[model samples]
Target: RVIEITLTSPMPDFLRLLAQPEMGIFLDGSGAGPMVRSDESDGQPLLLTPLPPEARGFPAREQWQSRARQVAVSAMPANSAVDAFAAGEVDLVLNGRLSNLPLADTGPLTRGTIRLDAALGVFGLVVRSDDGFLAEPLNRQALSLAVDRSNLLQPFNVGGWQSTSWIVPRELANGAAAQGERWPNLSFEQRRDIARQRVAAWERAEGEELVLRIGLPDGPGSDTLFTQLAGNFTQVGITAVRAGLREGAELELHDRLARFYSPRWFLNQFHCRLELGLCSEEADDLVEQSIVESDAQLKAQFLATAHNQLIDSEIFIPLGAPVRWSLVRGNITGFEENRWGLHPLFPLSQPPT
Candidate 1:
């Protein structure tokens, strides 16, 4: 059986690179034989091996199966793929870029045809610096407090945009013992006011103004997010400017999908060894302990503690789950909506029973 898949990407080479041995998202001793590639000019075909029913992570009633012996892949721009899909040239097209998202709902497309995976992951800015005005913990907390997360995606108006102020997803956390989000009792106005005072105190002490540079990917969605963020910073008496990713911005957007569902998975992203940002060594220690701490109950305790520590550190500003969407014809089979935002290629080629 031969299956053809169209993947829309600005640089599809990135997909092949990430699937390399020991380089994929998960590091759990699982070797990297699983991959998705197809005949390019080299005439080599990449195949996907379906995981057995018992080997699956996310719960599903259907059994996993593969119907494709050969997979053919075509990579093109988002617009081209959208056009092809709308014209019924392809049965499926997977693309996830806010700038290129086709949400106009025209042609044969409707809300029913579009699939947004409720992907579990991070989608916000990580504070990449520990110097200057951000050196103070109070100021960093204030930065988080000032923004109304719900306003960040007002321009895109995408549905089901879950805004968050916590480190771990509420669903995955053993954080039942803990209280709710930071400054829980405070309103958005009150939080902004407090943030303003904190920035004022810092300026008075240093006798200078405070400026923040945010590095965001190019897109209208990013533009809207930055504008809202800039407004929040302005309210707190701090200057906000857009900077290139390599221009040494204090805050860089960190967007990634979780490979599996676990609070520990979320916390490890901030481990000190990764140097992702200003992370706590104590948090790192807790994560290391959770790895071998046999007792499941105690392990949850350790992970919960580590998550709280990182949340308090405010290294990464929590926005919401990463948004991923795909266009599929109604007859397309096996496009299960999983939290990882990954729709495998082999299963997608299966014929509906």
Candidate 2:
């Protein structure tokens, strides 16, 4: 049986899944496969193509038109997709960024629900290790002290409780305290004074300006944050150069700092690499040990030790934790919320009548 699934937008992950053997679904033009449709010459399945507005007069559309069942896949700005779902124009919707929108107690869209999961992403700051000024622990600590994390979360309405720690929240084994409680209390002005004193002493010893390059994505929000951070650093006698880069540009080791998110496994590997300088014998051994340790407690301890070492070295300055949410129809079944906030579709099915 062909199960017609509609997505609000296309993502590479979903497209790849459709081509998997277990799914038993085939593209329309491709003949004789695991899945079939009524119109095909053999027992093959139909692959429907959505012609998004961006595809207008494009060669790709001609290819899609000849091969698959055509449908409109126009860009629905944010909440507009919810309206389309309400009108029964589509069967399934894929949304990545859903803010805090309240759901109705009961409605026609009763059989579907939303799942929140950690988007394979991370956001943090990276300092150039070669910068002699940044090499000092006090300098790194002072830089961390200057960030206003609360203001950062205002746009997304998520991630304001505390700054991020070296360990990922869901993976941390021990019952740790709230991240906000770990840091010392110091006002922004006071923090600047502390950093200034430390930097002054360092400049006297080294006889050089403590200049830093702050690489930021060229955007309004990033610009605002960069300005604020630059101002804060300037107050502490740190000269900051705001270098704007195109999205997805390759940053060299000497480039200012950058922050991004990745899958948990990748992030763990990254932590090991940054601490152990990547692919070194020490990093490889530690990673192997953590994975193979049979005892849960021992494994936890090992990971914690790794985390502590990374934090103490200041490989990356963690900014804050992510708060995520999802919206679903009233009748959606089998959707469970996990610590990481990821919702897999395999476990979910339409509610029984």
lDDT per residue for candidate 1 within 1-353, as digits (tens), equals 23365543233244543543336443464433334343345533244444543444445445344433333456766666778788877777775655455332456677787777878888878899989878977788888888888777776667888888887887767664245566678888999899999999999999999999999876555676778889878988999999767578999888887755677768878778887778899988998788777777888899888887887787888877788878878987878776667766666645776
Error of 1 at 77 (Å): 3.9
Q: Which stretches of candidate 2 lie over 4 Å from their true place?
A: 1-121, 155-162, 170-180, 184-191, 245-285, 322-353
Candidate 2 C-alpha lDDT tens digits along 246-349: 32211112111112221223235445445422222343355457666767667656655555554556555555543344555555555665434444443342
Residue pairs that clash (backbone atoms under 3 angstroms), model 1: none
Name the regions of candidate 1 deviating beyond 4 angstroms.
1-39, 42-71, 102-109, 175-179
Q: Candidate 2: minimum summed lDDT over ten consecutive residues — where?
A: 249-258
Instruction: Indicate which candidate wins on lDDT.
Output: 1
Q: Provide TM-scores for the models.
A: 0.77, 0.53
- Clashes per model (N, Cα, C within 3 A): 0, 16
Whole-model Cα lDDT of every candidate shown, in order: 0.73, 0.48
